[model samples]
Target: MTYLGEIHSRLLDHRPIIQGETRYFVKEFEEKRGLREVRVLENLKNVIQETNEQILPKCTETMQDYLSQTLQRLQAASHLVYKLQQKEQEQRKLNNQHLLISEKQRITQWEDFMTEQHNKQAAVDEEHRKATERLKEQYAEMEKDLAKFSSF
Candidate 1:
């Protein structure tokens, strides 16, 4: 193939990769779909490392390879970051709910304890009043007996 034909062929091959990046970046901007964890990005990382290794020594090759790889890496990072943020937010919400429930339970238990204490105090007070009344009756009877004996 002629030198110009070689360049044309390489450009044609790179067109798809560049377009793939463009598509994802555009999708990110549009926010048409919510982030979904389709798969682990271990493979993407491996691909980036491989692309970097190969593209660095051969600068004459298509520059589009680096552009494509860079964009893909950026998108993967963004997706992972978004996913982690969501998980953290959900955990915080659950923690708040748990704390609220525990607080309510503690309040109810305290109220119950207070009611029991009040009931016990009322019973003690009634018993003391009854005992005082009995003592007063006994003193009155003793006084009457003493007065009768003295008169005789």
Candidate 2:
């Protein structure tokens, strides 16, 4: 045989071996790829679980603290409003009392003025009565003198 024919025959003999090697390598690569995918999934699951265990609680606690502080601030504001209402109420009461006192003072002054006017009227009436009595006595004396002259 020629050298080319010998080479072709040797190639035909090695074909089955090469095909078998190719199939085996493909199977190994698929298995390694599947294992790597499974490991990646497992690592992802672990990371998710860790986040749940560590970060979630911290976030929840921080949110709770913020809510608690908000509640306290609301309560403080409510208390301040209550105190302001109470102060306003007291001020109103004081104002009413002052108004009442002023009214009483005004009434007292009115009563004093009325009493002074009554006293002045009484003094004028007494003087008029005394003057009328003195005029009657003088008229009686003049009539008595006229009667004596007519008899003479």
Task: List, residue by residue over 65-109, the lDDT tens digit for candidate 1.
Answer: 888898999999999999999999999999999999999999999
Give the Å shift of residue 72 in candidate 2: 1.3
CA displacement after TM-score superposition, residue 70 of candidate 1 (Å):
4.1
Task: Give the Å shift of residue 57 in candidate 2.
Answer: 3.6
RMSD of candidate 2 to true structure, Å: 16.1
Best by lDDT: 2
lDDT of 2 by residue, 84-127 (tens): 99999999999999999999999999899889888878887777
Winning candidate number (TM-score): 1
* Model 2: lDDT to the true structure: 0.90
**Candidate 1 whole-model C-alpha lDDT, 0 to 1:** 0.83
Error of 1 at 147 (Å): 6.7
Clash count, candidate 2: 0
